[model samples]
Target: MRGARRVPRRRVIQRLVAGMTVGVLTTAIVFAAMGWFPFSALRPREVQVAETARIAALPTTIGFHDPDSYFMNDADVNQTFDKMLATGVKNVRLMMPWAGAEPVQNQFDWTNIDRTVNAAAARNMAVVGIINASPQWAVAPGVPAISGRPASPAQYADFCAKVAARYKGKVSAYEVWNEPNGAQFFAPQPDAPGYTELLKAAYPKIKAADPNTTVIGGVVGSVTDWGTWLVNPVSFVQQMYDSGAKNFMDALSFHPYHYTLKFSDGMAVANSPLDQTVALRRIMIANGDASKKIWATEYGEPMTATDEAGQAAYIADLLTKWQEMPYTGPIMIHTTRDRQTGSTDPENVFGVYRTDWTAKPAQVVMKDAIAAGIPKSPEFQRFSAITDPSYGEVLTPVYRATPTVWAQARTVSTLFETPTGIIASPTAVADKARQFGGIPKTPFQNGYQDFDLPSGMRIWWSPATGAHAVGGGFVQAWVPQLGMALTDEVRDGWSTKVTFEHGYITWMPWVGFQVTMT
Candidate 1:
């Protein structure tokens, strides 16, 4: 059942890896690197919102995860790109299979990939190349050799670096290993730290190769948690963040396959795959990374037992639902063409086009949906203090449409309830009354905000550091200092540091906080 573009049913696949268990944590790397700098303060004596903060919007676009361009003839590939252009597609996710690219150690064959990248680039389509499929030499002894990860993170990192360097301006983004949460793609068992290692090692090299290209992490598996071999998107993402994944990757990628359910079916009803993103959003928010985007790299419905029109309706509904999720980036439809026609298996038919290259009802639905444009979710204003206020400063400047909305919406919906616990704020500020564990004792002054927690700790925020709790040992350490926290605790490579108006505190992994004065 595991052919070119199809994945087996979750129920059936889980039984295959039945007694398997995921390694909860990977070994934390302690680098003996040497680099430090003096605190050049960002908190001005008199702060202004315009000078200190900015907000930009992320617009949604539709694309495809098709293999025609990679395996088809040159003329056929050009035709495929032309069809995509005609369908109003703006993005494409192509595979840069590591096994096929580098069969021998340090040796490479860029034939199919170069063709795919060049074709997409020629048509002005954005390409997100997924770097996966480990080769024989790269896989360690006894690891499930097929689609297994390289034994060392450096090997995968090197391959990713080469792809970035080769496709410099062509590839818009790179998805680091597809569905590592599933044993099918990751092999043996899923490991969060192992995946994080690949990201940590590849991220810097990818950035060094092409700073403009986005490095997407967390290409999680199916919607719900069925077994240890296939971790749920939410749990896997949480584990990734725990393993220091936040510092790496430009955006988080996911495959929210909703099976037979309609996107309109609420989370409680469908066990909604799209709503699953809200949980991932919460993880990002709690980790001080609400600003980043979550990409739906693969999603679609199969036309096996269902009516073609019903499949089209499913796609149409998905498009409408995704527009309300502001945190979502581009959505790549599973495949452009069907793997087989008249096949009883649902896995072989997740395509908008038939095997004969004829357009299906879903294709027309997709074209119309893209033409209509996507809107910002209504809840976009809720997390403005943590996400919106610093948008332009943190990420690259992308053109957002009118009305100035923030990227994500669902995470802080509950936190923004009123004093009476009723109306939510139309304007964005830090979380409302009860969220800081206490009521805000200060007014919103020119993009700065704070609240006193019940634990006697204070929550401070800045455009540079979002929102962070300054309490306990850090507060005890700060009580003897000259001024309040000017910035939140931040991690740079190996060490964690926070700056005050007069001095700062730095903490290493094993070593606790070290206080330093200006």
Candidate 2:
């Protein structure tokens, strides 16, 4: 019995040993296959600053046929000036009637102009005086009354020189003529020959008077295909460039009035103001004059007694759009107050203010838009602060304002900042974080995390729990509202709990949290 029990114990021991060895080998193989014993390497780190680009200028101006006549008295002028200054406007555009200045040959009456200039200067606003109108002495005695029409290029040059010399530094910029391509004043010309000649002669005179002053070409009217050849703004501009008129002016100016239609309709026409600008830019680029900027000297949609809200919306849209386009410079709405003349069309009511100088709804809307920041999409954002309360009253011959919100957002989208090795502020860090998540939020509520985990380790985040549940991450952990897909890892979270707060939970998906395992 003892011999039989000993033999059985040896076989059992051999079998147990073999079973233990196989189990250990299988566990080792499984660990090796899963690569669980090896360390994972962290990805390369890239940091970027999310700042908006400097957008195009928003210079607002007032179009005044005659400031003295329109305002009536010195008190009225002063009142208007005060209002304009309140709007954060820096420029005004006034048409210096050639006839009014030189009613008699060589006799210049600078009384009204001097008063206007002094008033504007006191308010710290620059003037862009457009020398227009034809004096009876300069034109054929029988020629119908219009803006100045000098008989010859030499005559025009002389008048321009005189005006430029008188104003000198007081006037920041000068325009040679108004609408030369139109039959209104620059009548009877082959293309823009008459206008080009006038520019060539006046350009030197203007420079001679005041080298510091900028000279802009007169604002052309229509550029539509249906427009007459003489009034075809595009043709006139092309011809002017062909004739070496580009070297004369600091900026090319034009009137982009979209008539009575809504802002969207005006934007839609084939050869509308915006489209014409694209064509102008191409021409400027083609002519190697890319440095020259285009100015919309006169632009606005007419408001009516019945449709004030529509007018307000149109103005808001126009300003917002202007803020977004990088090439658009200054935009001067046609008139600050509705005029008695010019047109009897009830739709000719383009006044931002009523006749009594009180602001219209459109005026309030503009102030609000500028104050809140011009929205990029009319559907998304609000206006900025009212930097100027009397923006409706004062004529800014050369007004320059800041870009709207829409412009700012677009700028941020394309913005890239080179590292300067400077420590970033809390606000700056928050901004960057928001940008990374494709969600915009105020800097105060930005969420962040810090970690000190070991190197050569990767961190991942998910709404799920347990091992191997990493890849099936939910965008709910990322973008809670817009339902965006997670395609990229935004940042590395250190040994800190990142808690996002408020509307930020779903509102700003641009920030999130994750932890690393060593």
Candidate 3:
């Protein structure tokens, strides 16, 4: 399976050094006197989307919204991930139940997240980390439900920063909150302004942590049935832009799951995507956000257990329809495996595979589609098995997880400096450390840090010369293969520098910094 290549230590240092320059990755960032960054200081840079491509990447790394991602143990995580890879799907949309990860204020348990992310990385899969729900402690004081909005949007935003810092490279995309249009996820009521406030707060923080990580907004639930709990998503999303939602998102996420609608229905649902989603796009186009992509965040049809052929038909139909749409990116099915042990649960029927991890016709369809490069197929308007009451049943799912490690307390003080500065977390620096050959012998001091590469050659950071990390362009492509920094950050006028065995890398303001060979 093709996975992300691990850059050699020499190459890692080389790239950072090569790419390390002001205005490349981001405007050279500066820390406040007390190392505190106000939200204003963290305003998210506009997202940079890749060119629209055929099939959204070869073999189409279709996204799958894995169910109960938070509850899985390590073994089950691996099992589930392997199954997904087998289906030719390499991108996953996972729920990061915020309350579970952060039961206590300012404290986080990364055990499950670590497993989930590392598992995906090991398989060369990219993950979309969806931060969801309000932590009980952070819920609005007057609101009684745990699902209520946070007491302060900043609190949520800060939490988002911490998550992004921790999983910068491993998780490439983030959705601020899920399905705010659906009252169930947002609770109390779906408040567009409230969700907008959250986006406003979190957007800059996540972007500040890693500008390359895709930040998606308008995580709207598909509008089908309407009640006090639901509003027209199309109308609601337009309200988001009215609330100035465009400033924060790089892409828009749409969950067009009209559970009762036929798969062949496409985005043509009467009150749903055909109307609302289309309107949402027009809002983007009107607002000059045409370059932003639209993601089918979650779309799946429920059927009786015996409706294998029906499920297969839906998959075929969705792939063809989705491929034909230019702006639509990542058709993430609602699931990978059945979620229940019995047919009594409607959710169980959404998986491409049966509960036992055995291939259903849907699974076969998925495999064949991947192999055949998703050729056009007939769409399904109806599945007969769904109408039949005799076919519903479920088997015990395979691969139960027995987690060996659970999350424990970890703090920001545990973090280390990265090419960016002291702000990048230790975990985010893990790969850099690996690629740099070894950890720095000297502790990071002042504003600079160093690494010990092989061959007596070293690399360092300075206010005069940026580290080797370039933003998304040329600097990334240019660098000396390997070296290490032997010294900590040392102040130099208004900037700083780190001394490597080879030379000094400096960082200042607009002029940036430069490297001088010893």
Clashes of each: 0, 34, 33
CA RMSD for every model? 17.6, 33.0, 26.5
TM-score of each: 0.64, 0.58, 0.60
lDDT of 2 by residue, 1-518 (tens): 11111011010111111221223234233322322111121221222212111213343333232233322457867876665655544566775666555555555555455556777677666677777665545664434333325667788788888877776667777777776765545544324766778888888998999887778874676444334434456777888888888887778887665544433333223455654655566677677777777777666555432366776776766676655444556766655665532344543366666666777777776566556665555322222221233222111111111111121222112111112211111322222322222211212112222111122111222223111111112223444332212223323343222222111111223543332211
When summed lDDT is taken over every stretch of 10 residues in candidate 2, the lowest stretch is 4-13
- lDDT string for model 3 (154-200, tens) is 98898899788777766778898887776666757788888899999
TM-score of 2: 0.58
Candidate 1 Cα deviation (angstroms), residue 185: 0.3
lDDT for residue 93 in candidate 1, whole number 0-100:
85
CA shift of 106, model 2, Å:
1.5
C-alpha displacement of 93 in model 1, angstroms?
Answer: 0.7
Tell me the lDDT of model 2 at 140.
48
**RMSD in angstroms between candidate 3 and the native structure over all alpha carbons:** 26.5
418-486 per-residue lDDT for model 1 (tens digits): 343322221223332223333344444443344445445555545454555564456656644535466
Q: Which stretches in model 2 have alpha-carbon errors above 4 Å?
A: 1-71, 188-191, 223-230, 260-268, 340-348, 369-375, 378-518
TM-score of model 3 vs. true structure: 0.60
> Could you arrange the candidates by TM-score from highest to lowest?
1, 3, 2
